[model samples]
Structures are given as C-alpha cells and as structure tokens.
Target: MLYKRGKTWWVDFVDASGQRVRRSAGTTDKAAAQELHDQLKAEAWRQSRLKESPARTWDEAALRWLDEKAYKASLKDDMQQLEWLHSFLSGMKLPDQDCRASPCL
Candidate 1:
C-alpha cells in the first residue's frame, strides 16, 4: 500500500518473513510509487524463496578480488588495474554494467 507523506509517496508492506517494511517510494507520482512498491515486494519474495542475495556493486567485487589475490606475486599489478577500472565502474551494480559500451572491454 502507498500513502503520501507530504509530497512524497511511501510504501508499506509485509515481506515473506512477515516483517513490515515502510519506506519512501522516493516519487510523488502514485503510479510510480505503486510500481516501486511492487518491485520491492517481489524482490523480498525472491530473496526469501530463491535464496537470492542483493546485487553487488563493482567496488565490492573489486575489494573481494584484491583480498582473495593478496598472496599473488602480481598483487601490485592487480591493484593498479582495479584503480583504473574504478573510475569507470564505481558505484555501478555488477549486473547492470554494460561491457559492450565500455572502452576497457
């Protein structure tokens, strides 16, 4: 369900775990709010039933890669590569990144 708090629309729903989630939909439009609410509810269901984790960002993956490859002799080279990639991929979700459009690819 959606309700207006001032000008912004907020969503309220119960997840698969029976936890009540209340958050701003971040939009003033009713239709957009409804769509956001549906997406959030669906994501919660998928996470609970399919054991799916939330999408990871490029920075998280880069850090994990560095951690796992810390013992490698070429760790310095890996760090430099990651530093270059960071300017292009920072804050982007892994699945959302388009390799085809990237010059690095």
Candidate 2:
C-alpha cells in the first residue's frame, strides 16, 4: 500500500487477509522506494508459489509486462494498444502463442 511517512513516500507490502502485517524498509528517495516495491513484489510472489504453481500463461505474462512498464511515458498509448490487441485476439486460435492449454479428456 502507498503511504506517506514524514517526508517520504512508501509502497510496502500489507497482508491482504491479515491486514496488520507490514513489510517496510523505509526509504527517503523515489528510486529506493521503487526498488523496495520490486523486492516486496518478488517476495510476495515467491511466498504465493509455495501454495500454488508459479507457471503463468502468455496472457498473464503480457499483462505483467504491461503493468511493470505502465509508469513509462508511453503508458497510455501502450494501454490503448493492449486493449486493441486483446480485442483483436479474443476468439482467434493462438496455438503458436504459448498460452495455457486444456488437455482433452
């Protein structure tokens, strides 16, 4: 969650269910705060994988890439492109696209 502590802005991890757990290493600069954000995301992901698969589909990978790069100057336009791309590919077969497959029973 994003919070302001004194003169610094922090984006640390708060447990979704627990609501009281906090993982914060205070940072006074934007770059450091961002680095901490990445570290927290990584840690959360690692923890989550213990309960479920870490494997992701192509669609999820694309979405993750978009999220990671969304702070860039081209973010708005990139989002537009993503919307268009998703729409265009909605019902199309993507056998070569490296997506998750459902095996025949």
Candidate 3:
C-alpha cells in the first residue's frame, strides 16, 4: 500500500513471513509510488520462491569489498574514496533494488 509521509510517499506491506514492512517509495508522485511498491513486492516474492539470500545494500556491498581488499596497495586511497562516495550518496540503493531478504522493518 502507498501512503504519504510528510511530503514523500511510502509503502507498507506484509512480507512472506507475515511481518509488516514499511519503506520510503522515494517519491511524492502516486504513480511512481505504486510502481515502487509493486517492484518491491515482486522482488520479495521472487527471492522467496528462489530461496536466494536477501539483496545487499550498496553501502554494505561497498564496505564488504573494501574489507576484502586488505592486501591492495591502494587500500587507504580506496577507503578515502569510498568515504567520499558514501557522503555524496547520502543513501544508496539501486533504482529498483530491495535490499532485504527478511523483513527489515
């Protein structure tokens, strides 16, 4: 379901495990909110059916990559660059990505 929170829109739905999940649809437009809601719901259903691990957030993935590169000669430079990237992004998620396998309400 799509609802307005302040000036933006949000989606709230029950996941496969029956937990309530609420997240920002990231837009104020009704049609856009509905599209986002559908996308998130479909992705959740697909993952549950396929028994795949939950999608990872961009930040989590980036940090994981940094951690795995301890032996890289430019690790320090990479870390600094990552910090800058994260700061710029504010919050990072792919346009249609839902980064939760379990209900992360």
Candidate 4:
C-alpha cells in the first residue's frame, strides 16, 4: 500500500482464498517494512492452512485474537495498521502447494 499522506509505511497481499488484505506496520524504515511484510505473509499462510485444515476463517480468528488483547491501540495507529495490511494483501496469489518457496521467502 502506498502511504496516503507520505511519511508512513503500508503493505498489501492476496490471501489463499484470493481475498485482498492490507496491513500497516507504521514505519518508514525499509527494515521495518520488510519485517511487517514477512509477518503478513506468514499470516496469510497460517490463514490458508486453517482454511484447508478444518479451522476458522482468518477474520474469525483475527477478531478473536483482538478480543483477547488486554490493551487497545490508538485509533490513528489502528487505522494506519489496517491500511498497511490492506496494501500488502491486495495483490498476492496463493503459492502452489508443490512449490518449495514460502510466502515470505
């Protein structure tokens, strides 16, 4: 995801089910963006596995995880984070099952 106003970082990806998802890691640093990218890829993989393995949808699990968190983030940060996620998830394709490459790799 391109930062809407600059001075921010975002990422997008496409999940296994072909849904676009975005996430914001909230840093302009290249290293940080890379880290978030890896995390988001992992998330997509995990979600995809859940779909194939008799588990809940990513949304369901995400909401549950959010509900379990004891602390709340600032609204501004939350929105930014969401943007980043959407950007990272938007253009991704599910990896071939026989391929050795991991999503983050």
Say which candidate scores most in TM-score: 3
Residues 1-105, model 2: lDDT tens digits: 556678776675654334343544476787777777776666566656555333445467567879899789988888888788877665443343333575533
TM-score of candidate 3 versus the correct structure, residues matched by position: 0.63
lDDT of each: 0.92, 0.63, 0.80, 0.62
Report the lDDT tens digits of candidate 1 across residue range 3-104: 999999999999999989999999999999999999999999998889888788999999999888899999998899999999999999877445788854
What is candidate 4's lDDT per residue for 30-59, written digit by digit as tens?
Answer: 678878777777777876876544334435
Error of model 3, residue 99, in angstroms: 22
lDDT, residue 9, candidate 3? 97
Indicate the TM-score of model 1: 0.61
Per-residue error (Å), model 3, residue 12:
0.1
Which residue pairs overlap in candidate 1's backbone?
none
Cα TM-score per model: 0.61, 0.35, 0.63, 0.42
Model 4 TM: 0.42
TM-score leaderboard ranking: 3, 1, 4, 2
